[model samples]
Target chain A: MTDLYESQRAMRAMRRAAIQRGVVAILDVGTSKVACLILRFDGTEHVLAGDGIGAMAGQTKFRVIGAATTRSRGVELGESCAIQETERAIRTAVQAAQKMANVRVDHVIACLSGGQPRSYGLAGTVLVDGDVVREHDVARALASCEVPDIGPGREVLHAQPVNFALDHRSGLIDPRGQIGQRLACDMHMLTADTAVLENLIYCLKRCDLELAGLASSAYVSGMSALVEDEQELGAACIDMGGGTTGLSIFIKKHMIYADAVRLGGDHVTQDISKGLQVSMSVAERIKTFHGGVVATGMDDRDLIEVGGETGDWEHDRRTVSRAELIGIMRPRVEEILEEVRARLDAAGFEYLPSQQIVLTGGASQIPGLDGLAPKILGQGVRIGRPLRVQGLPQATTGAAFASAVGLCLFAAHPQDEWWDFEMPIDHGAARSFKRAVRWFRDNW
Target chain B: MRPMKDPAPSRMAYRMNRLMLTPRFRLFLRYGLPVLLIVAGVSIWASDEARRDALAERVAELRRQVEERPEFMVRMMVVETGSPEIEAEVRDILPVDFPVSSFDLELDTLREAVEEIDAVASASVQIRGGGVLAVTVVERVPVAVWRRATGLVLVDAEGHRVQPLDARADRLDLPLILGAGAGAEVAEALEIIEAAAPVTERFRALRRMGERRWDVLLDRDQIIMLPEDDAVTAMKRVMALDHAQDLLARDIVAIDFRNPRRPVLRLSDAAMQENLTTRTRVYEAVVE
Candidate 1:
């Protein structure tokens, strides 16, 4: 736990220094594609004083100078399966973006879609020392939270204070200068597989780049894909990518739960390939151009030729109806959605004040996803696109680029986390005892 | 929800919460900005046009403050190697205001201005210690007095006019040159005058005739026409003959040394009559 806290602190300091130097790169290492974006900061202090009052305060002035996306290689189920091939893919994407931006970047903040992220809601309370509650008291309250062991092979990714209460006054975002005797904090900590993170760090080191910051793609996808009100009230972002479907739940502008399903669009593609007896590349092309989960009566009349390069002309000229293609695609998408629904149910998302569900990512572009998502994932489901940013190319501003664009925003203005504060060093033993008690209170 | 003692307090809290939640308030906080900023920007841009002018003046004032430090100020100007009169004229032509910053003064331009004066041969300007502006001038010295049709002008060895002389006796120590192109030929004329220094009192002036050659005018209206190529040598020889045999003291009116091999001397009337009597007696003796 100390090692994890120390590394998080070191990364936060590095990120701050990088931001001060004016330019940083955001790389989204996803299952199907690798995207890189170069963001240039103007070093304006407007963000420091505004705090959480406005979302645009910190995001008003950054520009994307370069962006590049390439087909991911040697990555299976959103994790690197082959080191050399993944390194080459990363180098190609980063070099192309550097060429476009005309700058050599050393610091990069990366996001990954794998790693099996798990979110925990930990609550802590502390006694205010003086008549007024100060920043250190809030830090003490956050430090008092009992961080679960989360097993041996996982590390904490994000530990952010989601809500605060001072004495009888609840729903206080910042209780500083308030007259309170007891301060309480509700923190949301997300942890991921440790080996997956270590693999990414090793890959970045091999490429001669420094990892200044890291975030789970599910958390960032909800940040960019959901609207402000959806995030502020309650919502969930389901990012269906090539090999993984990421789920993130947000309430009061904080992500409280994140999970991923291994089944995704690639499963549907494989199903089509096997069912139609076509090559993988042709299946991908047909899926992109003609595949859909929802079919109409007219789809039966439409025919798509599945081309093959065999010497037999008749065998190469096989045709399939659009209905048959939909038939192959719908079940897999339904299965992925069912898995997502199970995760949402397990997270107690139905009890939230607003159960809005936003569906986004490359695979969410199926013709009738908006119509089918609500029926399967409950009501208030909408297809979410990434928010429009300055200088974004028209082609790159789609559901597919949500994680990359969100990574840019996250690089610019990261939410303050528990590790950002200074904790008292003398009360380690007492703090541990209190943390154990709270752990029991939270679990049993 | 806790109940408020009065509706006013609860209503105030509700209004504050509602205001904080409004998108307009968020925009106002993010970019629409503090009212002070808008007021400052609009007031600066929309007020009297003199605001911009005042801003420029303020910038210039700040630059002046930085540039006018004690080390950069030129407190005194010292002129070296110039006569009192030339130094005064140098001061007049130099474009510098005393006690001004040296950065404001262009030393190259000052040097050029000082050299433009007729008496200044060359000049250099530099900044010395103790806030001093040192100007060194090499004044042109008068070597000959040119007698022009208008007046007498003192000219240097290079035939550049140094100053205007009031009278011929004002600079009697300098040699006198006469004619249209005498100023340009002052060097050769001075050479001839030096060669004829033995008859310094009898030498009146060197005249440049037809823009070439020299005619030496002596005290008794005797004109010695020297050839152009070896005029200096001819003058030397004439001076030598006059010194050895008192050839110039005799009753000769003119000597034509244009053809050096055949020198001709034109005699006075009395000497011509004596020469006729002597030639008749010599002729009778030769015939007998």
Candidate 2:
């Protein structure tokens, strides 16, 4: 296990990088804000070693030096929708943090909220011509997934042969040299739309930064939000952001599924805007200041001044009871939870051993969200904060910036890079964008 | 006085010089000279002993170093001899405590232990601490046995010796080639259940004659006769054939490709299986 931790590719240079100056950076791109953290990775060598992360604890030795956040431009939900705006936001946050650290980086790994993502479970079998089942047999079984022909312009993001079964036997790890007549494999394949990734790459390129990596926001959020036990037992992280709500499921310490919904906190603000006949700015302010699901007994007499700039003096200072604010926010939060629940149920969540639900991201901090969440999501529900990284500042360590902080962790300690599919030929020969066209196609 | 001193010695000077030659002066030289010599001698002896001890310790240290130096060097040598380019590759994965693959080859200690298993031509073992080991091989005179696609196995004399190396092409001495399941009977071989051993300085290969008789091929490409019925006659026939035929004289092609009776001999491919008449064929036919 200790050896595996060092050899895992994501922490590639982390241990070595930790030895010198102990500095690393994390950048989180969201619809509402772009945040960057410059961590001074110190006191981590021994601490990381204590965690049994030997050898490469060499890389986790910096302290949290500085952090910066800027209002997001054209990024909606998670995916970069507009180049100039997203680039500007990324540059602003990065420059601010770099100025604080007085250092610059040439590479950055950006994460987006959504893409036309799909998951497929595939199984394969090999007739063991030789008496011993070996590494070659495993390779052959994984290779037998067929091209999948996800079409041109799209690429396979992750392909893992998650399970193996020897002849007549099932669920084996490493059948090598075992006298098996046949070998079988089960794989999980994740693919995303090519254009969505291209836009992210382009935005980073505009900042003159190489796209070192790209992650699904939901996956990283799940990594930060889910505890060890919950991750092992099975849990879902529903990251509620301004533009979209990201959902991810973890089992056996690996993310088995990830997805996003376009409906998020912005929708709630819009709902409040239309219902109260107020502008978006007023609606957001009210949502943050007066929002609550469970009204206390004293809330009946509480009054909030609803202001308008119209000429009528009475209309300018209209008063509304605090109960009315709860009435507006409760249904929207419930709707998001309901949609998440439906998605989880469809994914066979009941089969999982643990059904713990964690709500994170900026929108999850809505008061009384935890009390209302369990009723809609399931038995276990909780608000989650990003595990405070070694060198993170107090300002960046909030539940609202969980996605961004988690993004920092993602950049700091990415899980193993996947198969790195060196495809023989481009799947692009097939019809590109046809499947997802119905999504943006109907809207456009 | 600007003048030189007188050459004559005074009486007073002579008297003082005599006092110096008295017993006290004589005794001082005797004791001090001898004592100094003894002390110097002992000091030299002690230094020599310390140097000798230091030298012995160095030799022991060298011996230990010699023992350790070979483990890694030998392992790397095996990898290099097997694959010329493997030196770089082996070094890259250095300090590996385990062999990359263990089963295909193991140092053949137990298998080579049997006295009758002379078929093992040569063997060597190189172990890298990473558990990556290289076992180098040179197979023995496989008289005959089965060869398969999976790997070649060897069979030795006594008609019973069974080993996978018998079929290895590199061990050209083995001629009794058969496929899988064909070598079952030979696996039951005894050292001499078949016959008294031939005096075999020039013996090269042996073939199973129809699984019933045996043929021996000599180094000079001569085939010697062996009888199926009597072990003694086969021996006598083989010895006589060596003497009478002047077997080593001609560059013989085959003693006989077949029809071993009378052991009809041939010199060329054109003469293959020629001169084919003899009483109840004695048995063995071996060609180099």
Candidate 3:
């Protein structure tokens, strides 16, 4: 048991440093495309030792050695519609990224956009041996946290003890060996369906990369795009992608909550394709060129020619007003934003600082998106771009790739994971555990 | 009718008496033979080869475990740093003096054999690394320097022997335990000592005496003895009290607050010796 715990601890620590060693790949399965990037970090000293304190300044950084994007195949919306189709797409991206980077990455950190995730806060306490609470005592207290019954067929994705205190004193970061009768800890845990997680892991195994770690797309996107101040002061990053819009909240430089809405840019594209009697490709072109929610005075004369393949030239082309285009796009955009607004409210956005909301994603690049955001998402809105990372190509930095880019940042600096904190092999429910230990000494 | 014979009865009468005298004897005669035969048959079958093999496997596993090393994994890390070479000041301790497979013993008994070595924290000769024997030594992470009347000695909080002070305080943040024989709790005492590392720049020494108590000597002439049952707990309470109220800044000689709930203060000898003062009780907890 102790050996298992240590190995788990080592695996968690290896993730960030391993990615920077110039051998990391990302697997993103979305409805529109199966995107993959093999980031080969190139620099002097790939791993930073002792609290990222290198005075070399900007001399060290990662460069995108390879990249690939394949059309969404065998995937319905964000989740897998069929396993074999998804695997094929992943293989294409992996091969492309590998061919470009000139290396084979055998480890991948995958990100998922859709899952029913709920946030729960738990606190646990353990009595110190005598009155001096040591580091082991605090760890024992955290292990005492009752892993919630997140329902069957679901596995815990993240279990992190964020805060700790000894006795009456709080905010003791590493209370390993201080004396106190009571040591307390606050922990956060995230769970996802075992089937969903297993499917992703299975797909990656086929790609020949070990599943190193997993993160929610919304969570990584929030980390990559939100600035230090935005993260510290509190802000919401809503990533409007091809198949889904990911939402996350950041505070204290950590992503506290993450969620997603199934509706995305594809839905709007479909509305236009069906409304304009055009193919998805043509609808996308028109949406990119003149898609707007709020039609102004200049939009009325927008004479767009509709063409057909038939030989009758007069019947083949018809003049369409810009207002009609706006009419077709506005409702779908509103529906997506409304779904996101509900998720924000559910996440308790009112409690966070600044509460500044930033919208980014493939659809977020639409012309009238900035105007449409405030009406549904409230005030303090802006378009966000991922910043402070190296080795990213300009083609990959768009709002649509927020999750993939944010994944690079996550790969660079992961937060304190579950294995970092020391816990006894058989950490149990605190109250009964204390009672049982004390009882055994007395009875046996 | 058999009693009519008085002193003794005939064999036929005796047999009849045995059957009638005890309720259990009659009951056994009715049910015992079948049960005894069944038990004897089952016992005969149970001591068979299949059962014997299972027991043999269990015994073998237990014996294997008994021979396994009891030391921590770090001690067996292949001695990655040091090298074996012949220099002018020469040492052949690696292959000859302690031949490749010469020593085979655990660390508990060997600690005392090398206690006099100033540079050695603790060492053990072990038979490992593929038939090659090597000395396993744990260097002390020094926390403080302790001075005594007889001599200057280097000791860990647990009372294990260590190297003398090197004046490199910036490199190591450890607390010193003075007096003597603190080795038992020294391993655990390091935890308390390290907790004060961030707060206290350098601890003077933690002195042990009376075989039951402790005193942490900080800067100047201050001495602090810990509680008996939970010394680490008492030290933490003291640290907390000191951090919150600055208890250490005040001029003091000895503190006898072994009881965390009841703190007793003793004035420092510097002023007491000069003015010829007596002991005084300052803060006392009222018993319920």
Q: List each candidate's DockQ score.
A: 0.01, 0.00, 0.00
Candidate 2 residue lDDT tens string, A1-444: 123222333334432343343545567788788887776555543444433213344454345566888878787656678887777777777667766775555456566776656666777777764689755566667656554667776655555565668878875544667788878887776667778777877776766555545667778888888889988889999999888888888887767777677768888888888878888778888888987887887777889887876667887688778888888878888888888888888878778888888999889989888889988887788999888776577887777677666666665554533232222121345325644654576588
Highest-lDDT candidate: 1
For model 1, residues A1-444, the per-residue Cα lDDT tens digits are 677778988887777767766667888988888898888877465655645432332434688888888888778788888876677677767766776776666689999888888889999999986689877788789988987779989888999898999888888877778897999999999988888888888877766677889999988999999999999999999999888999999998888889999977888889999999988888999999999988999999999999876667887899999999999999889899999999999999999999999999999999988778888898899999999877777878999999999888788768778887777643667778877776888699
Clashes of each: 0, 41, 26
Residue B216 displacement in candidate 1 (angstroms): 45
The per-prediction CA RMSD against the true structure, in angstroms, equals 26.2, 37.2, 41.7
Task: Give the per-residue Cα lDDT of candidate 1 at A431.
Answer: 73
- Tell me the TM-score for chain B of model 3: 0.43
Question: Candidate 3, residues B1-288: lDDT per residue as tens digits?
Answer: 133322223334433543443456656866896788889997887679897788789998886565443431223213321322211111222223332112234444444544334445556655564444345555554444554455544565445555445453633445555555565556656766765553465476667776567777677667777876777777877788788887777766666778778888886667666445323222222221
Q: After superposition, how far is residue B94 of candidate 2 from its true place, in Å?
A: 83
Residue A326 deviation, candidate 3, in Å? 1.6
Between candidates 2 and 3, the TM-score winner: 3
TM-score for each predicted model, relative to the true structure: 0.59, 0.51, 0.54
Docking class of 3: incorrect
- Judging by lDDT, tell me the better candidate of 1 and 2: 1
By TM-score, rank the candidates, best first: 1, 3, 2
lDDT by residue for model 3 (A217-318), tens: 878888877888998888999988777788888776766777778888889889988987776877777788878888887788987776554456774576
What TM-score does candidate 2 get on C-alpha atoms? 0.51
